[model samples]
Target: MNGLFDALERAAGPVTFAPGATLLRGFALEDAAALLAAVDAIAAAAPMRHMVTPGGYTMSVATTSCGELGWTSDAQGYRYAACDPDTGLPWPAMPALFDTLARDAAAQAGFPGFQPDACLINRYAPGARLTLHQDRNERDFGAPIVSVSLGLPATFLFGGIKRTDPTLKLRLAHGDVVVWGGPARLRFHGVLPLAHGTHPVTGAYRINLTFRKAR
Candidate 1:
């Protein structure tokens, strides 16, 4: 266990993107197995599915959630709901491991006392891309957003507050955790189209778990 922690630290540590954003590379390495297990349990309760946007277009990426609230989109709009619209039941509870890791990452990123009530899970396949958008459905932007990347690598686009503002491209790999809050809380961000590849953990797919404080 000590050796594993040492390996993870050697791989990467906290990398600051700005005053309010920090990337903790390899932060989830040790907990990857447990996290995946938790995800499996959540998916079993609430299956992953592609959702349609208000614009009447189906999202390329598949999504699901576990926590008090789950994110969903339809002709009405994108919003968080207390239950899975498809299942008509409350989303699976967020695993303790997921909660702990998110809080730890948030503290390391300079945001303490972070308690997230929603954990959005996104699955991307080859050619799947997320367009620039802000996470505004949450009631409080004061809490930081904790995002963990798993499986295949992806290029993360971090943009300014405005959609048209300049963007920075950063490559993210498995076990990476990004925490952003304060001024960076409402920053526009998105994921580039995934490339065809098979990861040792999740073959031909990339899984992202984003923890948020939503009421």
Candidate 2:
């Protein structure tokens, strides 16, 4: 894996990477602290946990949610549920700050009036990675996805509709926000295995907040 990213390009954009995808560099730095605090509170209410895929493998990332619905995966399959399977209660409400940031980020990315009903939080430690996959479980594909990165940096892979299509490996660091939708809604994406590192804000892990309109 040492030379995995050698052929890929690092993203330095506050620019559009695709027709409907925008990478806003440092867009969330201003709200970083507040967001982290909110994340802590949300996690306290509904602790993050590793989920099991239908195939029975445990995901490397720890996850939680704060919204009307939370995505869950298990022996049954992946689906959105109103309550946290671990807690047997509704997930914490999405914070106003999170809602506002999602809205503003979406608007800035040319997808105005975006109101996300779900915010999936993912925590990744060193060596943790997400494989290429599409977010197609949402009830509506008309809504865009807004993702915020915090803590240690990682390479984000954005690919075409098919998993075999060429992918772009973009360096997504603290406070970076990526919004994609429209014709790019079903594009495949994932995160490369995280490198070992420490960040002042997140210690040894990275936190990602992904907002989506699930309903």
Candidate 3:
């Protein structure tokens, strides 16, 4: 109990852990609101859509992207592209807040000089979930991943490299940030099915912003 509390306190600012991971809970409620607004603006430009996996399966989560490069998947396999296959247009530019937050969060996590070129925005309604998988589409694994969660809370399943490895379940609420890089960069992770709930701002949905250095 004390150890957990200590970890949380140590994570007060941007916090670094393991080789390729960090967590930042530095943003306030207002910051969260601002980020949500940015997401809305980007979504207005490019609506979220469920993408097809290389295995011919449509992902359960609806996703959109911004920045110089966007992550995508299809029968060809997972990779980053300059344009959205759905619309055949360049992805919306990453919001200034998104870049600022990613850089700040990465620095806090101890990965100084991190500059992400891709930001994947995910929207989840009740029962939506992500299966455990590594984020390997990016060209650089040395850079870490910065993920921010907002709206109704969800359980995050942080697992090891192996698919069968035991996982730690974490309850992540609005404004919570999770960073994983270094040795943990390729670790398996996913979200559990979200329970039905309503948030004052987003109604009955959750939004997650996952920033990466795809270039």
| TM-scores for all predictions | 0.94, 0.94, 0.90
Please tell me which predicted candidate would have the highest lDDT against the true structure: 2
lDDT of 3 by residue, 83-162 (tens): 98888999999988889888887777667898999999999989999999998778899999989999988888888899
Question: How much is the lDDT of residue 133 in candidate 3?
Answer: 95
lDDT for model 1: 0.91
Error of 2 at 42 (Å): 0.6
**Tens digits of per-residue lDDT for model 1, 93-127:** 99999999999999988999999999999999999
CA lDDT, every model vs. true structure: 0.91, 0.93, 0.84
For model 2, the stretches where C-alpha displacement exceeds 4 angstroms are 1-13
Q: Candidate 2 has which clashing residue pairs, if any? A: none
lDDT winner, 1 or 2: 2
Off by over 4 Å in 3: 1-20, 26-28
